[model samples]
Target: MSNDQLAAVFNAGIREFDRLTPQVWGPAGQSLITQLRLRPGDAVLDVCSGAGASALPAAAAVGPTGLVHAVDVADDLLEMGRLVASDRALHNVDFVRADATEWEPPSTVPAAGYDALACSYGIFFLPDTDQSVNRLVRLLRPGGRIGVTVWRRGALTDFARAYADVLARHLTGPAPSRTDASPLSRFDTAAALTDWLTGFGAHSVEVTELSNLLPATPQLAWDLILGGAMRAPLLGLDDDTVESIRRDFLSLLTERDVETLDATTLVGTAVVTG
Candidate 1:
């Protein structure tokens, strides 16, 4: 997808983070923080920080003395992050409205300067993953760490697959290849992910497959998408097509029941090297 197209998806999808925050974020945030081993007074940058999910936890870990820069291309999402920081009286966090793929660090974040950097479930959206990864790496101090997460496989992500399949069936034209349309969707294989991460000059790179429950039914899951992330693409669909997809998806997931969908993400962490 083009930048504008992806940006629109991001614009529409930001709210989904908030709606599913309690179930989806708790483990993600905890795992990322644990991996980074965030210390008191550490200056951390969370790229594509949707709704401050990672920022809030980082702020708590770094305490009042440290800093957390939450960056995203979506202004609305940044505003949400600002509100979250305000509500918590978190003086250490700052929100920046910018694209991670082309972000220039401010003077406060010097060349190779941050104590650590994070892009939780965010890197996959960038049109140029390598370039974005390099930019994020630049923000980190030498020996500092970087943490990233991406969806592992579509088969393992029943909700996402169902949503995508439904949408794919309706498009009269050829469906966009994952690489052409959504690079995030392309790295579904462990081998592909491993090669991608290692190619980015990540050293001591550790890869782990993490899974979690959605804590909601298939219908509720669809409702979350309807109410949040998928609003834009979904709005473009005709009512008949939309209903068909919904019915098909429901029938497919009836067996999963009202439990957390067995969603898996491949998490990779590595230290920046000169």
Candidate 2:
């Protein structure tokens, strides 16, 4: 999908995204912050800072003295993040609407560059992943750290397969492709993630696994897909077709006896040696 198309889909699903934030993206964000070892007064750049999942935590972690610049392509998501920050009275975070793959920080951001950069579950959408990584590295000061998170190989595979099976049976056109071809799949493993970071000139690359298991009902599974990454695929389909797919998808889940959702994430961190 084009950038504009992706943004529109995300904007439409912002409400659902917000509901799932605490369960899916929230812990992943915290894990990224912890791995980056952000300290008080540290400046952080949260790329793809959707709904403040990571940015809000970074703001609290940095305290009143520090600043966090959160950027995303979806204006609605950024606005939601702003409200979240306001509710928390976190004046330190600035949510900006911009493309993570191509945006440059405004002059108001720290001239010395950021101390840490965190991007959780957002890198795969970039059209040029390597170039984006290089740009992020350049935005960091020497010795500054970068942390990224991606879904692991087995993470949600069963759920996804179930959904696809149902979708294929309902749709008359070609079945939607699996997510395995996504750019994020490149870093689904620790070794690949470490290698990618090192190739980007990041030193001391480390990859860790975070296991998140949540109680799953068929409805919850459907909601997750509708509100999250799967939103793009459902676009342009008729309501009847979408509902049919949803029904079959839920039935498959029940038949498979899937009890919980395992959204295991792989977090990779490294420091710029420049």
Candidate 3:
């Protein structure tokens, strides 16, 4: 999909994404910042910072003297982040509506480079993962730290498999093929992520798994499918087909007696060595 289309998909489901962030990625971000140990005057960069889930916390950690530049492609998400920052009286954070992969700091930010960069659940979205990591590294000064989080293996896999099965049986048009590999799947394991980060010129690479058992109900499961990445595939389908998929998907979940959503993320941190 084109960038605009992808942005639209995120925008359409911004509410759901925001609701789930606190339960999943928010804690992961907290863990990341805790590891980075931001100081009072540290300058931080948050790439693909959706609704300031991580950026706001980073701003709080950096305090008034520090600054955080938050970048994302979705205007709505950026605006939401700005609102949240304002609500918290966090003037240190500046939300910019731009592509995280190619965006550079404007004059308002520090010139040398950011002291730390945090990208929670976003690095995998870029078309060129290595290039994007390189870009992020370039924005960091020597000894600067970069932290990233990606969904771990088996993260919502059962739910996705169930949904795909339902979708395949219900889709009116030819159903899309299920690929064994997912873009984000590459970073599901710590070893793979460490290797990727090392290849991207990150030294002292450390990868840790953060898992959360999120309480889930049938309704919440349905809402998740409608409000997250899976939403994109369901778009443009007839209402009947959509409802049927949902019904079947929920039925499968019920049959399996799945009560909790396994939200797992691989949090990777690395430093730039001169």
Candidate 4:
């Protein structure tokens, strides 16, 4: 699906998405920022920053002297981010609604460019993952930090297959998995992610696995469907059809004994060579 489509889906399910923040998005975002080790005065860019998950934490790390531009296509999500920033009195972070692939530095950014860049669980959404990220990395100053979070190999396999099986009954299309042609397939593992980052204008690559295993509860299962990219499949379905799908999906999870949602993520960070 396109980024615009994704924005629509996410915009329609903002509540569900935020509900998963504590168990799903929050940890990975924190880990990514920690790995990057943003300084107090660093200028940062966080793309696909849903509700400012990583961006908020990055703002804290960068403090008042630094600035963080959280860019995403979803306006509602960005509004949620703005609210969170206001609540926290975090004036350094600005959540802007824009296509991250074409995001440019603002006038306030130093001419040398951003001191660090981060994208938590977002690279897969880019049409040309490598090219888009390569461009973002080039926006950074020499030796600046670049970090990304991605699903580790086998992460959410059971949940995805179950969701796809349910979808197959309602829709017509091959289930998208980590096939050779898929962008995610290129760097789901630590070794592959290391090499992928190195291929770009980055070095000193570090890949850390953030093992996040949450209980496979009915609420989380449905929230995952509505909140994240998986929601794309249910775009045109009516409420009744969605309810049916949800019922079947949860039942299938129970039948398959998928007790844990493997949210295992790989947080990869590197120093951009510029």
Candidate 5:
């Protein structure tokens, strides 16, 4: 899907997207922050930061002396981030509506560039993953750190497979997969991710494994499907069709004895020594 389609899908599923934060996005964001080991007075640029999940924590980590710029393509999501920042009284973070693939630091950013950069579960969406990331890395100063969170290989296999089976029955086109051949497979493994980073001249690459699993409650099962890019396929489908797909997907989960939703992730980090 194009960038606009991705943004539109997220905007359409605003509530579900944010609702998944506590269980899915939030933990990964916190882990990214911790793995980055942000310091007080450090400046951070969090790309694809929906509702300030990682950006909020990054602002607090940097404290009063530093700043955080959270950028995303969805205006509604950015509004959500701004609201959260306001309620939390985080004066240092600004959630901007922009494309991370083409992000550029404004004058307010330090001349030396950001002290750290982060993105949680949002990199594969870019048109050219490695090239886009290389551009973002240029926004960081020498020795600065960059961190991103991605799905570990085979993560969410059962959940996604069930969804695909149902989707395939409802639609004629190909469905998204949770296993091999997916776009995410490019760097799903630690070795692949490390090599990708090193290919761009990043050093000291470290990949942390975050094992995530939750009970397959009815509510969560549907929300995971509605809350992300997965919903892109269901966009133009009629209400009854979408509902049928949902119900069938859930039933398949039960029939398969799928008790857990695995969201295991990889938090990869590297130092940019220019």
Candidate 6:
């Protein structure tokens, strides 16, 4: 999809960030957090921090002296994140509406520098993965770290296979291009992900696979795709196509089988040096 199309689809999911943030972000982020080894008063940057999923936790981890700048391209999502911060009385967090792919670290942040940068399940959308990694390095202090999450191979997650089947059945025209074929998708594997991170000047890189159960139920899966970031490609489909896709998804389920979905999360981490 073109950049505009991707943005529109992602923007649709921004409205549901408050409701879907937990499910969408959960285990996918554990590995990243594990790698951070956050310290008191450390500065952190959360790129594509929709509704402050990682930002809120990072803010808490960093304490009063620490600062977290949560950035995303969606203004509405940032607004929601602002409300979340306000409700929690968190003064350490700042929500910035900006394109992570193109944003540069502010002078304040650069001078102070960050100990870590976290991008959870958001790198897939950034076409220039190498450049984004380089920018994250630039935004960090010496020996700073980077943590990222991406979808694992399709076979690892039944939901992924189901979705691919849904798309194949619904879309008649030249099979809508695979979403994972994007330039960044090359990092789906541990070897590839490690190589890319190392290529960006990382000294030590690690990759981990995380899997969890998604709420089972056709409706839950529907909500997941329709109400979350996955909504992007779905929103692009025609109504009839959507129904057909939905039916295909339902057909794949067994008794109450629709009540739970198997999902896996892939995480990659690296530290910058030299």
Index of the highest-TM-score prediction: 4
What is candidate 6's lDDT per residue for 116-234, written digit by digit as tens? 99988787667666776677678788898888888666522556556766676666554444355576468877888888788878877988877766766665676666655556557
TM-score to true structure, per model: 0.82, 0.94, 0.92, 0.97, 0.97, 0.84
What are the root-mean-square deviations of the candidates from the true structure over C-alphas?
Answer: 3.3, 1.6, 2.0, 1.2, 1.2, 3.1
lDDT of 3 by residue, 150-233 (tens): 888778877777877777787656444325545676677889888877876678998888877777687668767765667877
TM accuracy, model 5: 0.97
How would you encode candidate 2's per-residue C-alpha lDDT over 5-119 as one tens digit per residue?
A: 8788889888788878878889999888888889999999999888888899999999999899998888899999999899999999999878877667677567878899899
Ranking by TM-score: 4, 5, 2, 3, 6, 1
Superposed model 4: Cα runs more than 4 Å off: 173-180
lDDT to native, each model: 0.71, 0.85, 0.80, 0.91, 0.90, 0.72
lDDT measured at residue 116 in model 2 versus the true structure, 0 to 100? 91
* RMSD (Cα, Å) of model 5: 1.2
Per-residue lDDT of candidate 1, residues 129-239 (tens digit): 777687667767888888876766762355665556656776666433333356765555667766776676667777777776455575457655654445446657778
Candidate number with the higher TM-score (3 or 5): 5
Candidate 1 C-alpha error for residue 201, in Å: 3.3
The residue-level lDDT of candidate 5 at 246 comes to 90
- Over the stretch 1-274, how does candidate 5's per-residue lDDT look in tens digits? 7778988899988899888999999999999999999999999999999888899999999998999999998888999999988998999999998889888898878899999999998888777788898899999999999999999987888888889999899899787655454558888899988887787678999999999998999988889989888898999889999999998999999999999999999999999996
Q: Rank the candidates by lDDT, best first.
A: 4, 5, 2, 3, 6, 1
What's the distance in Å from true for residue 17, model 6? Answer: 4.4
Deviation from native of the Cα of residue 241 in model 1, angstroms: 5.3
